[model samples]
Target: MTFPQNEVRFEQLSTASPSVIYSIEEYPGRPARFDYLSPAFEEIYEIPVAKAMENAAIAFDTFHPDDLSGYQQAVIRSAKTMQPLQHEWRIITPSGKIKWVQANSRPERRQEGVLVWHGVMLDITDRKQTEAALRESEATKKQILKAIPDLIFWMSADGICLDSMPSNDAFQLFPDSGRVGKNLYTVLPPDLAEMRRQAVEKALQTGDVQVYEQRIMLHGGFYYEEVRVVGVGDDRVLVIVRNITSRKQAEIALQESEERFRSAFQDAPIGMALIGLDDRWLKVNPVLCNMFEYSEAELLTTRMFTMVHPEDRSILQQYIEQYLGQSQTKDKKATQVELRYQCKGGQIIWVRLNLSVVRDAQRHPSYYVAQIQDITQEHAVNRMKDEFISIVSHELRTPLTAIQGFLGLLNTGIYTNNPEKTQRMLKLAMDNGDRLVRLVNDILDLERLSSGKVQLAMTTCNASELMQQAVDSIHSIADQAAVTLAVVPTKAQVWAASDSIIQTLTNLLSNAIKFSPPQTTVTLSVQTQTDSVLFQVRDRGRGIPADKLESIFGRFQQVDVSDSRQKGGTGLGLAICQSIVQQHGGNIWVESTLGEGSTFYFTLPTPDP
Candidate 1:
């Protein structure tokens, strides 16, 4: 017989409801039984209604034997005492299926002494599945916490430790043990625990997450933590702790790097600054401040154009606008633009400016980076050099005019007693005069090169032919110095200015012959490579001093000043050679051993096919 199932029906009538109903009745000499089962129970137990009503024992037999006594106690207590029984038990159905059932039964005390049990079975499988998922998630969280190299704790709203996962013990990274189910204050110092409590309390009060940084004294050192506390529920909170001592150290390193940048910007040998849009001063370092004779505050108030000389301001502005526009289109290059800028002290400083553009995230112009160098000294030196060249030119011209006049008169037999003697005297005068003119021309050429006044016409030519021509031009000097001169070429073609390369070779060969001991050899050689060509002049002479080798190619710079006295020649030969080589996009340097020999080496670019 079945018990009434109206209350169960009312409780589970909704479509989303998961509760199932069943009716149980106990009869005399007949086992207690279910009279009816709801539709959901069929699916829950995988049982058929007809078989369960036919034999009640079919369901009871498959219960786990260990739990049978508990189930029996619950049913018997409900029958004898007329109380409700609430218990969970496993049942096997005729379909050979096992299920968990939570049964609540009530016994009606009546004259017949029959017991009736009525209850609903909720398909709590999904609930059990949710519980299992929660358990797994908690276990995974604990595993992750334990795997971390840092200490972690979860504190309740009242500052109680609900749970904690301490790190591994290999290094005893987390010193605390016995962490769970204790008050937070019990485990920490009063001050640190109070700080954490306040942070959590603040998060609770505001209902917003809070993050804080804290330092704790640990095993012989301090540990820095970046803590984030969030309210998980009305009465609970979650805390995440990350050890940030290394990150703090890294921040300190970054600070040091910024200090270096600031120092370099302020005290650089060259004038440097950060200029923003609209010509405003974003920053002016010490060098730049001094260059403009303005304090940082003053520079911030003044526009960048204020420092430009009046005569050059228009051109400077035009270039600035052009650069800003072009910088918007592509990668900004460090550009060199020479202009005149007036100092606050009214001095017009000749400056060579190298500027770079810094852009914003959207690729818009942000600011300008300027590197300015004062070139007044170089300009003055160039002027002095020009004057020296003019003086030399005048001296050579006077002598050449007199020599030509005397030679012409002697050839006409004017006031000449011995024609052959006059002719020899005139020839000797002509030779010395030509030497003087050559010396003056060399000095002038050097002056022009040093001042960047000479223009080059560059091209690719035969290296062998150039070397041969250089050898021919210097053969007379080699013979005069009693030195053997030779030309050797490893490659046929090289790229360079023909006239400049010849001049360079002539200077090298002349220096070799002038410095060589009698009967020594002077060799000119050319070596070619994939990208460039190397030309060398080697002389067995008193080689350059080791310390003075670098300056030997500078204008008026010589290895031995007394060499000029003995040689009676201008000291601009090597310097001119160096300038010419550089203009051809090459380099010139010397390698030598004292008293053994000196080799002057120059390189020119290889011909591009």
Candidate 2:
């Protein structure tokens, strides 16, 4: 009954074990009997240790209904072979609760027909629950990987692509470049592959995640990737590459926009500057710097007031004060001021300055953008316009006075006393009326030509025919003037408006005849060139001065005031001819020497064959 020291230790350890030590003896009359059961039966199986020892049926009742057959078969097989039995199965406790237990035992057959099994049952329910949770977490991780659009790769330390997620794989930068088991260097450019290799090495060496951006050309377009590399294990790294092409393109576009603004600022035809609230130059463009003959560095250091002329300085100061006193706003009309600025050469120049307030994100006024345009020539043109109006009014009133006087005499009974006097008065009135009509017509034609409103009926006409028609039309007038009419015949064809060309020729021929001495020749001629035809009217008359030759083509211009009145010249003939010929893609000019003959020339383009 007494045991050795080591044997007693083993018995004490087995009794204290967190498992139940059990034995079942098999017989032919019944299934089995529990000859021995450990004290763990009460706490683990919710059964009294003594009651389970009363019959092996207590242990049999604990077997889960579904696992009962497997448990029975395992016990039978182990008993037949007298081998160790190991099985994990479910057990139903006395309290109607299910417990997962692992039954490990050995089987032995003693004397005839007496088969016994001694087993140890340990509660394994917690382990089973933990395993189930692990499996579920792994499944969830796989789903997340599938749902994400980021391209992920498992790359070996040597830069080979070991695996990729999202099995379609076409979203990869090198889709058709043979992915799995292929080295990245084989598909990517040498520099990019080296960059990726460096990223992997960094992750592995530092044991920290590495993030970088890469620009690549793929699928016939530019692509940008924000790549993150993390070491998963010794031989592989996880790479998550997200497409950032849109963000990259936005950055590029912003840079280009900034560059364009800078270019416009530097190359603008008018001066532009950024001025601080204190009326100091913050930034001045090249044009502004050039206008003041100051370098950019110097201008930024100088105050805007210093550049204004002495008399204009007060005006600028008042406006600046007014602008500063007003509330800062947006969508408000810019204020424009005309002022004078003295240049480096000591000359005062007039400038029209327009200023707008620039705002910050919070809508507070940041600075003022000023555009300055030189208006010296514009002011001079205004003065000339005033003088031109006065001269026109005088000219018009003179003709009006003559017409009114003659018509008044005829309208009243003053001329009714005699038919001869009445007829003569009627003729004088008609002459004045005709001159007024001619003046009005000339003004309207000049206005229409200047406004670009006239639509010319362009066609190809024989130059010889145009000249002969002008001659025939002016023949009687030519006879009255006693100027001989002649023509230098030409067969060249030209592209022009028929009516406009004929009118230009007739005007030139009439002017020629009117200016020529009686018995002198007024010649109409056409000369053919490689690409166009030249029409000329030459007259043997007191020629124009060299200076007047050019001015005679101006609207209402006259070579001689006395001559214009004597020859009934409108002075608009040459200007009309110039406009018509120039509209046909040609040029017109007059060449003359004082006291000699004059030749007026105009060219018309030839039509394509």
- Among all candidates shown, the one with the greatest TM-score: 2
Which lDDT tens digits does candidate 1 get at residues 430-476? 77687676777887787687678767777779998888888898788
Q: Where is model 1 poorest over a 10-residue stretch in terms of lDDT?
A: 166-175
lDDT per residue as tens, model 2, 1-609: 456987788668777988988887887677688867777767788988888778667777888889999987887788778889999889888778888999888877778788778888889999998998999999999888877667887999999998888543455554433577889888679998899999999999988999999989877888998889999988789988877788899999999999999989888999999999788999889888877788899889988888898899888877765765674543457778999898777778889998878888887778889999888789788877786576567656767887788778778877677999878776777776777777778777776876789988888899888888888999999999888999887889999888888888999888888878899999888888999898888998888888787888876678776665677766677888888888889999999866788999988999998
* Highest lDDT against the true fold, candidate: 2
TM-score result, candidate 2: 0.58
**Pairs in steric clash, model 1:** none
Q: Model 1, residue 6: displacement in angstroms?
A: 17
lDDT of 1: 0.77
TM-score, per-candidate, Cα-based: 0.49, 0.58
RMSD of every prediction: 19.7, 8.9
**Counted clashes in each candidate structure:** 0, 1
